[model samples]
Target: MTMVRLDDAMVLGMNGAQRRAVREALVVAYPSRGRLEALLDGLDRSLAHYAADQLPLPDAVFAVMAGAKAEGWLPLLLAEAVAVTPDNRQLADVVGDFQVGDFQVGAATTGRAPTTPPSDWAVIGALADEFPDLPAARPLISQAGLPPGRQPAWNVADAETFWSEVHRLLVDGAVVDGWPKVLLAAHRARPANPVLAAAVSAAGATGNPGWREISGRP
Candidate 1:
């Protein structure tokens, strides 16, 4: 494969093979150094490190999200790639703007000429629009979350609600919250689960300042 430099205003499109090839190059040549990049979404590798439990990544989603967040990215691009992953529980378990699995099914069926609307998608949209976006995203957000409502176009209300719900799901652990702080809080709350503590500690890179810092984890 050849390296093609992409710039802002110039969207880069890649077949799965090309994208995989590039990801391989970064993994082999840089070995987690983050030498690769994406001008729009910051870098694909960046999203891979965030440690999302439902994400089917070989890397960590938290690390990726944190890196991109640190780089001041909006996570709009990788959001598309990761939007419909197999494990996208979105928000049902954790709490956010989407339920990944349901969202994907819904998104795939949206505006279809022959397919019926995914039930979950319709439910989520109806719920999100009802209250400025919360409980709905606790399972699924992103364009998939939009469904038949002016989708593919990010709405201002959706974006704001997205961040708000993410803060709850990811940082605050309102819905399952996250592993690190929750682990810490659990420990503080008494009767903590050692398995969980050890699991979190051993699940990813430690001391990340963002997400959790288990060991060489997700």
Candidate 2:
């Protein structure tokens, strides 16, 4: 309940109630024309801090931001947020959730409904551009299909050939060639396939060198 300033590190360690209290304090302090700007600035600083440290931001931050989104400035605030930290995956997700109007959890699920006219296709397009390999961005690309050239054809003759291509792409260190996108596409097509799921999981654990080892690379 203390009114200390909430920063990325401080918010990360707070429990849900404590986080809520901080958000409430923010609302009280910035009650007028400054409200949305203050909220967006805090969010930008938090996201920038995490991105600079190369660390993952916790869901708590997004939870509070979602609460703010319900106050009817979702698009403008989120668009500016994403513009400031486009590479932040967690921020991308918050934008994606509102874009699709999927407010199943967090403060968004409370009695306060999200403002109508959810994020438009332009915002979704920006997210897809920043995170082409992210599964979250895939669906937002277009109902017709994945983005141009990024889509894997998956036209192999057999299951073995399909997996062979996947493995080759991984082992050859073709990550820059969009191998992760291919792996994610495969997982989406066959969500029940354990191997595909594991590959997607492994691809995400990029810190582990085992997945990046090239047999003969100098």
Candidate 3:
């Protein structure tokens, strides 16, 4: 069989008016042999804009933004959730799947900062061997269910955003350990810093209905 692949936009119906408008803005709204970067900025704008009304967390919209080039311009993509299961934890494996190096969807970055840096398509159990106490580490490894590397390490990348994403996942209960008592305890004990206070509050509110507004633009 002469197999063929289908574009997510097509099946998801990005050709419609409202969506088309957003797509046209991104330029890659339709497939072409053009620079993928061209559509990235526009996609970022549309996702951010529409997210205010209805979060871009819908599968179609989420795929468009989450799958974009993450490294060169890291600011564009945010913590968009793809699905939510019965579990109280917000469904955001997509965020953990991302990498600062390769464009793979379910990649991970682990280990001490300024050292391990980042790796693509991580297996959480193996990565957890280092931290030993990171609640979310192994779950991330098992959940991503990564196969043998489709693309081997070209070289280590910055992994800055990757670290943050994983941390957010850990705090939100995406990982196995997902220590709320530890997190809340530390959060409460923090110095009476306003910024930290706000951070703590925001951290507490993830996966809430009200906060869904910018869920995709998270």
- What is the per-residue lDDT of model 3 for residues 139-202, given as tens digits with 9 covering 90 to 100? 3333332222321121324232333444455545553333322223332433232222333354
TM-score list, all predictions: 0.20, 0.21, 0.18
Q: Which candidate is the best by TM-score?
A: 2
Number of clashes recorded per candidate: 43, 0, 7
Winning model by lDDT: 2
lDDT of each: 0.31, 0.37, 0.29
lDDT of 1 at 38: 33
| Cα displacement (Å) at residue 138, model 2 | 8.6
Query: Lowest lDDT 10-mer window, candidate 2?
Result: 116-125
Query: What is the clash tally of candidate 1?
Result: 43
Which digits, one per residue and each the tens of the lDDT, describe model 2 over residues 1-218?
A: 11111233332445666544333322222222222344556545333432232211212234445644444433444445445444333334333333433442122444433322212122222222223343543342222233546434446553334334434543465444344554455446545433344455655734433333221122
Deviation (Å) of 48 in candidate 1? 9.7
Tens digits of per-residue lDDT, candidate 1, 62-105, equal 24534544555422433433332223322111111222333322
Extract clashing residue pairs from model 2. none
